[model samples]
Target: MGAGQSKAESDEHFSEEVVNNLSDNLASPDTPPERQSSLDAHIRSRIQVELARLREEEEHVREEIERALEKENLDRERDMAGDETDSGVGQVKSTTALLGDVDELRKQVERFHSKKDDDDFVAARLKSEAVVQCYKNNPSTTLDCWKQVDEFKASVAHLEERYVESLR
Candidate 1:
């Protein structure tokens, strides 16, 4: 701007010549030497701020890398253990799961008979999850919602008594 400066050159990396020229363009040449030195200091401070921001970014990236490496190591260890146990990495099948990998690896489950829904039905007065959720969601006044809870418990107990009588 002072002479033949373009927008592109102004955006280039800060150098002594560029910084002085930039300062001179912004301030009159009649500015005192002290003011010029202050401008230089301001430019240096800006550079330091940028450097500090870059260092912090680098530190964050390093922490992420370390976490990733740690996870990878743990995964490798699990894979090694699985290989020894003949499961192989992510292929560790549960004893109850449907696995066709025999040499008869799983000897316990002779059949996959699922239990009847009646077996899961409770006749006893038990707190259902929804009732517990009411207490959890409204911890300050659980006594306020006791009516609904009582109804639910009574309903379950009635169902359970019927189920027991049928069983007998």
Candidate 2:
């Protein structure tokens, strides 16, 4: 036969086989009334057992979910604590660096003040020598200049005392 004819014949055969199987199943004998009732009771008992097992499985799944959520919460709390600790450490490091900078600035100021004091001392000594030389040349004019020089020297001594006190 041609391929198209053979294919149509196979489709018809398959439909006939399905119809025969359905008719055979439907024509099977029915059970007696007492036997049918007993069979139904057995089926109901099995159904109750299956339902109990399914409920137990569901409860176990719920317990597992609760445990997983508790573990996740613990991990989140730990991560937050670690973050807080890291922030505290960063703050301490920043504070230490700032304090170090302040100490260096104080040292620089002290050095500047020391240099200024040395320059003032040298200038005062030179002025005192010049006044003495002028008195040796002109005694009357030198006398007034000498008095002014003495007053200036006393004020400088007072300023030096205050500077030393500040150092302490």
Best candidate per TM-score, number?
2
TM-score of each: 0.34, 0.36
Q: Write the per-residue lDDT of candidate 1 for residues 23-95, one digit (tens) a residue.
A: 8887866878998899999999999999999999999999999999999977886676678678533565543
Candidate 2: tens digits of C-alpha lDDT, residues 1-168: 699999999999999999999888678766688988999999999999999999999999999999999999778766766787787853222345669999999998998668666866667666667667767778866565766578568757865885788679
Candidate 2 Cα misplacement greater than 4 A, ranges: 1-29, 89-168
Off by over 4 Å in 1: 1-31, 87-168
The positional error of residue 36 in candidate 1, measured at the CA in angstroms, is: 1.3
Tell me which residue pairs clash in candidate 2.
none
